[model samples]
Target: MRNRSHIHQLFEALAPKTEQKEKMLQNILVQSRNEKIRHRGFAPVKRLRSAVLAAVLMAGLTTTAFAAAYMGLDEAFLKFLNPVNHEQAQYLSNGAYVVDKQVTNENGTLTIKQVIGDSNLTYILMDFSAPEGTVLDAARYRFLDNDITTRQNFQSVGFKALDDGNRSDNKISLVMSVMTRNSIAGQKVHLRLKDLQAADPLPGIFETIIPGTWETEFKLDFKDYSTLYPVNQNITMYGYEAVLKSISVSPISITLKVDSSYLEEINEAAGELKEIGDNKHLDNFPITINYADGTSETTAIFSGLYLSEHISEQILMIKTFENVINDKEIASIVFFDKEIPIQTGR
Candidate 1:
């Protein structure tokens, strides 16, 4: 077995490099990471939000994998996601695993396109369509129980439509993401959507759009492209002691776990954050990712700020990048005022 060394190993594999291999990765990274860091902040134990991840690639970083566009993930980002950028597309193209699993019923069809994620955040993109004659109504038709099943006590996070996939009347694209305390890198997830339906004329009811259920399962193999780094260091938060546990970065999103064990005062502040949805209390400490160049990206403009779950040792914070990123481009991660350097694994 390869040795797992601290102050180092996190940079291991994730695109292992020789002089030539490093050149290939540099070709990819040189073309990425100009966009902002991400949105979404520390939230309640496991509250799900229906949000879209809008990021893509540039012209130079295109690879054969991207050319293939195996399961439309490329298309999904280009057309479906709101705004596209040059971050992470190349890295994702080489990493995002493809499923292409499809299940059809009389009413419509469902196809599992692709997935890219780790333990904290896992995103699965899928396509759904109504049958020939009719079209799908977003307000009307939906999977009554479109959910991911995880054996490792993972929390089920809700999903939302990435966009009008295919831009067809009968079709819509969906992205389902979930959260967990454990490392789910290399874990298989069973995705099952049961009872497709539309809202009934009655206010609180539903009618069947598709008679049967649609289910597909796949494994997340993102560990090779995205690596989780353990910090195990303590930091001063609000003049209190808190542990900066671990951080894992991927092309699509960033997840960091900060541990403030058994702090009721922190919980009180978290309650206010959940209620107002802003960065006021306990937002003093900032996170920034430095690149190979002198410039760096900070957590300024986020998608959402959720301060939550101080009771548990976990502060579930997950965010996505505007572009794809690589470990080679990152020099160090700055949390609070402490700096954790990332070795190039050369």
Candidate 2:
């Protein structure tokens, strides 16, 4: 691994080199114009115009040179900063690993930590205080999975919060969930919180507002795994920890539905469905239907809004039809809905 200090030095080198080049160009332009005026005795107006044009051209050349140099420096710095083998450039290009920091508070105590991992999975542990004499209650953490589209398939395990009251140290432990992706169909998962309180409501309120509830979207792709593991067994995991002041219902929910007929039609056609209905009132939701077997199809409906918020508005609808095929009542349906907020980092 390249030392952090070395990276800083490299970055510093970039600035001085860039400045020196700019200074040299400026000096060159000044000397060139002075020589032109002295040797040619060109008219003041003509000389001035020539100088300006020359300066513009020089500036353009300088910009191009600077860009090339900067790119070279960037690549070099990345190579040095990467701890893994330099030969693994392809792995770095793909979304394989990431690092992050988190803070958490329980009751009144607080703790913070860092999270890092490869693509398969990782975990973060959080320890926080509990209200005096306040017994442990239920706890949960939420996050958004926006990168589902890039991966083949993605699965996320919820954070497991544990209370260890036996030790002299009073602390609540939190184990961040694991998220895995295996496919390209992108999807996002929202987090929701409920039931929270604090003795010092002001600080809690400030933290809530400062950090607030935010959504994190991730692009899922596994091309990076080939560098470290067998293609079929590549999995990356990471972990994080955060404090909790309070929990409340967030205005976000995700609904996944599968339809059967859409898949059937596609299979019959022997191609991907290219055209879909444009439901203007439904906020242009995208539908995907897949066939799992000959007799049944899975139709998935994704809405930009929550069904609860707009179901009464008649903004979207799903209609199912049943037909007797081979003495079986096969079911198929069309699905639609509005979007909803996704929770992140509780």
Candidate 3:
């Protein structure tokens, strides 16, 4: 009943009939507990009613109350980011360096929850809890390191922030990955967060902006905790021949690297393969990861195509579980359920 008033107001503001609106509200409340909403066992509303409520629901509209959804760090992360592989979550629970410390300012509080470091990537997970009705658009948030000019090896950085599915209007979680040419182990890296702007704006109402700065220094723990499976094999798919370079399983991620020459050949033969409508820069081929435990995950969210013009290398990088699974050996890479053997020419 935390946001009972706001929830009721949201429905009242919609143009649906009073009776239909009440019924929808009742259903949403019954389905969503603790701010976690799932479309299950709920009847679809009429198109007209849905149209009236669509924008509001997308704008963080909810059925009220804070459920046990985001009670803990792991639970909170899972609630918002399910597309992330389970290995990363397992590593956070096992080997990652975690300091559940928080920094507070007039704007709000920021916490660095956990971190995973390896030879190839440095991953950091953090949470920001601010005043109610806050909007921290991850696209606008920036990361700054003033001493980067003095550092070595570390290069590009990327981040993904999720707002617990609009379940809670006050808290947001972020996962940031920094890729380096070499290991970041034993190096004290100073990271500066600049221009973190939190906005609470109501169109045609009132607007507010809170700006703040946060800084932190941490060192990567160096250890050989990953298993590198040597797989230099050639496989044919969709009239194209390619080589599976290797699969690297670490506490932070599962990376599958494929040579690019084959892709280039296929692309050239296909005749300037223009971006498929709305599916830009992605190969239509389906790639899946199968584990010995009989579990598999399929999605383009964990995959990327890297084309290096200088080296004429087109490496297909499939990003899987962030952590390594010791009990489950990778069975094979499957394309459309067809197994591609991991040939070791030993």
Candidate 4:
């Protein structure tokens, strides 16, 4: 983890207003709650906003596993997800790593379909088989940490397989991440879900409410894990220069950090920055990661933006993956038609 003081210094330099500075500080604290520190004096709305943004950012961090581009079902279990893109939604129906542990209640049978992870994160694929015509519109889940015997924060995403008419169905697929930067090997994790709401048949009515709780426990053995710091390289996009700062890859997650030089000019203007999106500089950049195995996956940028007076200093983009990729095995990165080879900083 980076030094909080260093982060605070960067915040102090860029934030012009006292309120903005306070809000930024609150966001940092909210995202880094795993750190043992007490925060004081924050408006309730601001706190709630920061917490929601943290979940969103964390969820975005897991898009490398589940995204619009790599959504599909039925595959040869261990086959790399998109084979061509080899990016998101890799473990669709393959049961190579199936735990077979599940819970069945009135809602449905919540079965653990697949599991993958490392110290930094845990990615889970669950299959929900309900009565026919069932529509699981939304859900919530968490892992019970026994060492602490408490709950921890995580990021998640889900896809409900629609019918031929594009209508909802009983079988739904979900992928979730427990964003703990520590190894969960040989540890029993208690998982739970509640307050599931289903889509209503009537057009303008509320969703069909399902009131019940589903719980189960499972674990993963970390057979392999590795990390690499790629040589900082230069690239151009949207008529502006940027730097590919670093890359972190694992079975559960992969992360890419990009810094844009052009954004610095905009930030230096001392203008108001409603949020990272206000700049609209790094939006819709088709960023893809290529592994040594000749496979690549498109990544989603973390929604919560890192603010900076200098574009190069600002953590412009953070992309994460749920599919396993060895960082040391990374071959190249494809961004905006530019193929940047990963140079092991030897």
* Each model's lDDT: 0.58, 0.32, 0.51, 0.49
lDDT of 2 by residue, 40-132 (tens): 755786768678978987998898664442233233223222322322222232322222223333424433232222333323333445456
Going through the candidates in the order shown, the clash numbers are 7, 40, 7, 5
**Per-residue C-alpha lDDT of model 1 across residues 1-346, encoded as one tens digit per residue:** 1222320222222223588778987875654332112223523311222111112333333564543443224456433232222233344445566777888877678888877665566667787877776766544445678667776664656455654534448787777666555556677778778876666332536677667788767777554445678898987655566787887765555667788874555555434322123322333335788988777887654532233475476665665544444556778888775788876532
Deviation (Å) of 315 in candidate 1: 3.3
Point to the candidate with the largest lDDT: 1
> 66-152 in candidate 3: lDDT tens per residue?
111112224443332232234433333344454565777777777877665555566667777776667554332333322222155
TM-scores of the candidates are 0.61, 0.25, 0.52, 0.44
> Model 3, which residues run further than 4 Å from truth?
1-92, 100-109, 117-121, 129-156, 162-171, 180-186, 197-212, 222-225, 235-242, 250-252, 259-286, 293-297, 300-309, 312-316, 320-329, 335-346
Distance (Å) between predicted and true CA of 59, model 1? 33
Please provide the root mean square deviation of candidate 2 (C-alpha atoms, Å). Answer: 20.6
lDDT of 4 by residue, 69-166 (tens): 23323232233222222222332222123455789997677777665554445545666677667654433222222122124343333322222222
Compared with the true structure, model 1 gives a TM-score of: 0.61
Higher-TM-score candidate of 2 and 4: 4
* Candidate 2: regions farther than 4 A off: 13-19, 22-26, 48-55, 58-207, 210-346
- Give candidate 2's error at residue 67 in angstroms: 2.6
lDDT minimum window of 10 residues, candidate 3? 64-73
